[model samples]
Target: MFTLTTLVLGLLTATGISSAQSGADGTGGIMAGLITPHAYVQKRVSSYDRTGANADAIHIAAGATATILDESGPGIITHIWFTIASPEDLHLKKLVLRMYWDDESSPSVEAPIGDFFGLGLGQYFLYESAPLSVAPDKALNAFFQMPFRKKARITVTNQGQEDVDSFYYNIDYRAYSQPLPSDTLYFHAEYRQATPAKGWTTDWKSNGDPLVNDKKNLNGDGNYVWMEATGRGHFVGVTMSVLQNQDGWWGEGDDMFFVDGEKTPSINGTGTEDYFLGAWDFGSHPFSYASFGAPVKGEELAGSRSSVYRFHLDSPIPFTRSFKATIEHGHANARSDNMFSVAYWYQTEPHAAFPPLPSVEERIPRIYPVGGPGNAGKNP
Candidate 1:
């Protein structure tokens, strides 16, 4: 039911008219009366290498390439650009915009396209930009309203640190049939810890070792514990240690981290009370320990009495993957008897200042039971 000479020969064969073109309302030659000769072209089908020596950072590097532009169905991706001609100062941090239909382990949807002003994942969608200009080429344009599902994949990741060598992109799928409704959000994160060692007393030179100075228990020696899995993706950093026997506190102790198992309420005014990211209170007075960053808000650091806490989530604890954490005690008289010698090392990889080895092997056997009664007669 289209006749204006078949909608001006389907808009002159979708803007490619040429058959001795003739348009002046006489409508005798508008690509031969009603355009429909297979239109849709704006291509650049391949490009790859997201880093040197087999990707995944080995020298602070970055790389990316993917393009398939509309193969069918209502389309108008307009623009999805990139250009960071490296010159230094490219700490761009997280930029993942994935839309892979039926591949890469069944992905039908995903989103996070060049988010710099709107944080992304950990929550803020877009509102933070200042370092994308290098001499004359550092661009980013977004207007992706997509809907051509049979096949599509666009992945761009460079979680900030500046060193993004090169980039330039374009994707404008055109067509029209009415179909647009998909914004993408699938989220993921995984790292676990805990096994067969509860509350206290793992037999450290036994004599009912709950700390009469079994080196302050928990296999002491500058003791350090960790655990933090927040809003889902952006905190990227952590590595833990402790497997039994060291007893004799003096290198520092207490570095707890258990952010999303609920129940972190204990911060009562001090230097860092947001779930205590760092602590080494050797009975205070001149012995210290503290380090913080990220939205970890206060209180809940109670454990000590022959302590025994072990945890490890190395990196990728920001923007969810999957989480759970436990183990807290820092002197209060030393005898909380906590014990979890192993389990807690998750990964998605991206936080290496040094220390890398533990990417999941599965271990679980510590059900909370050592030096019971919650500190039976506490005294420091």
Candidate 2:
């Protein structure tokens, strides 16, 4: 299995850039590539006004789309930056971001703009990670290296009822004269949600009761799927935002990964918090890191909200035929909270078609009344 370290070190070869031109010492960070560069032309396509006017933002009407980038390339996108001003409620969740690689009709990347930037609740609080971040004052940034052979296109659609007053963006990419290496893979992200996961029963006394904990879920039958892909690639990470419908701790669930379409998961984790590199309900506090974080830690009560993320940059799980990344809603699939997530990966195209995104109303985060600690013994 190739790790992100291997991928980063192999970037020169993957992008058809010779080692002599890169001058990398294998000791410095990604900055080592900056020491020597002989080949590609670095370019940027931003929302700057073509007329060279002072106003450099685009206005997108409700139900309309804005083309952010359209370029012919044997190139790789290095960075993407965006800042927006809007009036619609939950505007971030209503804005859909899509990317097409090699002129494919279907997008390889389709996710809510906020979710794609690790703010799945449509509300942003500053958080930073290796490949994605929400910086100071609502600046959304991404550093994923997206390589395309023939063409690359990116668009954002306003699904809200109100028009987007201002949309600002800048996409930086490298234009290569030479073709990318054959092993280079395209990046992809897909969004999915379960307004409220269904459990066998919600009348349990506690999370550890035999009625809940003893029910085996070895196959991940009712697991909330983060990503399911049919291709050759590895899952990079996930951003998950949760709205609590039921009360009490909402993370006794375990993380499970079924690689290459196996009947059972080969990778199983201890618990939800543990999978994100945290423990004990994230110590009931917020934390952010380069590879994993719980940026929004919620109270153990109904209507609470939490957002967490994790990137498998250290050891990406590789799959040959398929990959299914899932996690139990609660131990033995026993919680009914609202779950929304974006799964990130790199794979060979033409990748599997993504399911249609939920309607704007459906995507909005809200708590649903379900029976748990809040009303454990009541009918639900």
Candidate 3:
């Protein structure tokens, strides 16, 4: 069976009546004919031989930025691969990714490079999911399909204190001869973080029953919002990292999704682990699935950290007017952990404005122990 993402993309890209809607009225696919054979074009944007030598990679000075890929479209970014030689984890959080679609001055996508590629906590571990993966020795891969009608620009900004002396990447995209359909959606990824999440300190466990003393939050007010936007699109899911602040499970919080500006969420999950498609505190095992996985499920302890992701490839949450995707910091919004997340979605161009990227000081993935004070979460 085709995943909903596959089905939607296939239907969206169909060449006429073949479920690939290549042009106007679906008749264009047939009229274009199979004899001429549609042409496919490809290009790679990489750190390669910039100075007439075989040496690749770029040395991005601290606080400087590089335009890695800039192309006129009627094209789709098919695959992206990246790896940094630096050993520090902070670089992952410091190096940001930004993409502009079809002449939009502001970015439609903005996030930390690592977080955007699934290492949300600024650390890398070998893991895989349908849309993203990590290989041995810190290789990062992303398979999100990004379609553009007029133009696409991708850049990497290094906000770190140390210069990135070695940065390698390959961005692969395919160019199309015809214009993309009007309904085709643009890709988006946004990042958010709240170290030592401002949660209740009273340890109000709900005993796993949502109805137990849970009457206060009808609007998901205190939930850790992964992404919120006003637009027409579908929620692709998120990359999440939870640095435990208490000695108990950090996933008792629920996943709540409010669509179309509803006061109450229409899609509510059972628990944080449930939203990530895990059970029993993720079994303390690193695992991957077709649509979801906890690639980095650290030890179940205070200060322990884990990275998890869920891709709604099967059924992306569709929203016509707006979307607010959030999850609790702890059961009943009671534990103050370090929460970092990147939300992925697809919508038409001119997307809702994104909040400013958090400062490097704020983006650092530090661990905060329960009841600790003053940036306990800022250091591991």
Candidate 4:
């Protein structure tokens, strides 16, 4: 069950094809040739007025769910755009996004709308990436290609107590006359959070002190997980938001990937910033790029929020059996900080059931009285 991402990556590895030349095959970028006719019919499901009026937005009452799209397919979703207006705070986290493929009873994708769009801390900030983006003035967009054979359904549930004043969207897709390739994999995104990651011990002088750095974490024990999946597919990327509960740097931890149930991580990185394609604590300023970035840089102090993202578009990590992506909170998992993240990938159907989403009160970011400069050795 190779995902389309894996197929492309395999081709690249086998043929010695450069990433920039990927579009030379007439399937990729602007070089894909808009002048050339396409095989599928372009379609869109949007929040538009049925009677052709100007009021194109819809209001979703509290605890209500809005089915944004339901269509029979041999179709592939290409793009999604949304702009929301709500009075409630943290509306992004309160709105849950779910999508199903091929009439599956379980959702293939489940996450907070904000996290899915790379706004993991329930706050809006402009950033762009190959698959997801948050544009000026609170516009969220996604360009992930999601293919389905029999059906595709997308919905948003309002889990808050206040109604969403205005919800607008445009979902662009391609309706194919023939069936999709059998090897095409479905898209998925799952959210996970640790309001405050528990550390082994708070008895430390500083981040680099021997008390904190001497411990070993060769197996990623007690690491905060980005995602875990039991399937055959490839991992695409992750967006993570961190709320500092301590007074030092929160990214001394390394990233480890245990693929196919290996006793130890087969793929490991030097540090969190290194895995995110940054060095020296992301320097003094924030930066954003097409594939990897830290858009919201936070101070090295308590009660600060930072969001970072990285997409393995050029090289999606493939797995045959299982994949568990995790990262330490600090060196050897010794930092107590709040973390929220969403992992994206393409996989075969019947994915492992996701863990239950945290309660609304738990999802909101806040300073937990934990191991830190202000509340050292205090319980959360």
Candidate 5:
């Protein structure tokens, strides 16, 4: 037992703590990359001018694909940054980001450029988190390390009608001389949306009748699924966009996670806002944290939209056989609202194919009342 414990401790010291310290982040303190030198070459692929001239940003024409990177790698993609200037607010949703690992025909990471940067509604806002962030001037940044043993291909598709006049980007990676670990997994980000989620058919707002609309949810049936995955891996986190079609707070929902095909969810949360690490309807304030944040807080009223995200960098939910993650539309599933999300995780190969991406017109963030257009434009 003593020998086993010593060996395990040594392994953890070299792999867990030391590995992070010696990553692309080349600075900090005693934990520095230079301390334990390894055979890895840091490289960058960007929209830098090929000539010594000044054409910095690439102009991706409408309905065209831009291959930002196609490289052979026993390497890890360390960082990614992008910024854009366009007239369409929906361009964020229309422009797609796709990345395939080990030369896979299909992309392991497929999502809207904005959603991948933690801006769910296809809108830009300055916010910061551990893994993703958006700085001033709509500069987006992502720090998810994606490892590939063979080859990696990354592309951005302009599905919009108008050209992306200026699309600036930079991708940094580290080429490793040694092979990746046996447990190293592929990074995947799949986008899902219920442009308008189904909820109670009628508006139950009677003056005298008090309806709590509360019920217990077991078995995880009919829940708004974020993503369901098979094999062994860990859940990183998700970015969510919520658009309110009714007049009032639209966040009474709870989060549920089913691990390994279990009938009951081993993990559950109190409410939507609570699961995002905020309370009292997020207090209608923008806040950023290392783990979770609500960078864009819309007014708690009809026609409002909010973007929120949570990253599980420190505490990743592990699953051995399978995992299914879902969240309620509202308390007891009682709200009809627009919802868009992207769930990020790292897992073994043969990932479940993602649901079809909705058409660009469907993703434009529309707000329509559940009951009808009788009381449209009016909050209450």
Candidate 6:
């Protein structure tokens, strides 16, 4: 019988203070408890679908507890390991690892544990025939390696159907003051465009022409737009938001995103979803949309005026002189204006290879309007 009392006790007992531990060097030394082992047991709802709609579902009574054992690191985290124990066989689709940094307001970083490494998404990451090999009473173990900074809290989420009665985890981490080889960097550029008429359609071009006129024209009004930094570091994560005026064109038509020299894929949904790197949409709404996809192009169609957009890179990116964005297409109803705003950030180091691109299922679409009478037959 797993109770809250047991869970709390588990955490407390697992976190016994380390009186003194030997340093990496054989020389005698005294180290604080910073590198000591810490543990936590928590109950969470398994809610995430990796595959299609037919994916398995997780149905467990609320308050099922999971014990997480964590070891602190010096600076960058090298790897993590854990195990899961369940009363019955459970179909797991995916696993999410979230890190709560010193700042409790939000997690420093959160990603699918399997996907973070080379492991594929969802059950695919698991070995076929054998989901995982864990004895009834024994603890299963796994490992994860990544470049990390500062202290962090990690959480494992089960996305598979079936009930996970209980589980235990042991995470091993190595920290160092030396930065990783790959560090993320961020840069910003400003763009502005003007159109001929109030209802005229135009494309907001980045390199070729400031004003573009074609079926894909997107920038409507002539105002200053801004792009901000959402994610940064060696595993450079990029995200931005767009604030625009007017509303007519479909959500897909008016948004665009460009990385390096090529354009990214588009995302599904509206508002922030349409915005690149936007993880949360439907602000202050009844329903919550938590779909994550690869980066995509964005455009603005309906709303004009000033809109903010964002971009994210999974790894450290080279320092380029400039990056650009443009409105692919816009509506012909109200005049649409587009502008660009910029911000800058720096990474500690660079990575060996360019970050991996997102999968098709994880791709996000550009920004566009949804569920409005004015937005009809406006996408290109």
Candidate ordering by TM-score (highest first): 4, 2, 5, 3, 6, 1
Reference-based lDDT, residue 87, model 3: 48
TM-score of each predicted structure versus truth: 0.21, 0.92, 0.85, 0.93, 0.89, 0.31
Q: State the lDDT of candidate 5 residue by residue for 93-157, as single tens digits.
A: 99999999997887898888888887778777888776777888888988777888899899999
Tens digit of per-residue lDDT, candidate 3, span 205-227? 43443543464655677889898
Give the per-residue lDDT digits (tens) of candidate 1, residues 30-55: 33544544344444322234554333
Candidate 1 error regions (>4 Å):
1-188, 193-235, 238-369, 372-380
What does candidate 4's lDDT look like per residue over 141-260, in tens digits? 887778888999999999998999899999998787777777778888999999789888777757788988889899999999999999899998899999998887889999999999
Checking candidate 5 for backbone clashes, the offending pairs are none
Which candidate, 2 or 6, has the higher TM-score? 2
Q: Native-vs-model 2 lDDT?
A: 0.85
Residue 344 miss distance in model 1 (angstroms): 11
Comparing 4 and 6 on TM-score, the stronger one: 4
Q: Give the lDDT of residue 323 in candidate 2.
A: 95
Candidate 1 residue-wise lDDT at 220: 28
- Each prediction's Cα RMSD? 22.2, 4.4, 6.3, 3.8, 4.8, 17.8
Q: What is residue 25's positional error in candidate 6, in angstroms? A: 29
Which tens-of-lDDT digit does each residue in 1-380 have in candidate 2? 53433433355232222122232334344544455543678799998999989789999999999998999988889789999999887899999999999989999999999999989888989987777888889999887779888999999999999999999999999787777777788999999999887776877766668888788888999899998999899888999999887777889999999999898999999999999999998995899887789999999887889999988766778898899999999898888888999999999988998988999989988766577677434435
Instruction: Give Cα distance to truth, residue 48, candidate 4, Å.
Output: 0.7
Give the true-structure RMSD of model 3. Answer: 6.3
Cα lDDT of all candidates, in order? 0.30, 0.85, 0.77, 0.85, 0.77, 0.30
Q: Global lDDT for candidate 4?
A: 0.85
Q: What CA RMSD would candidate 1 show?
A: 22.2
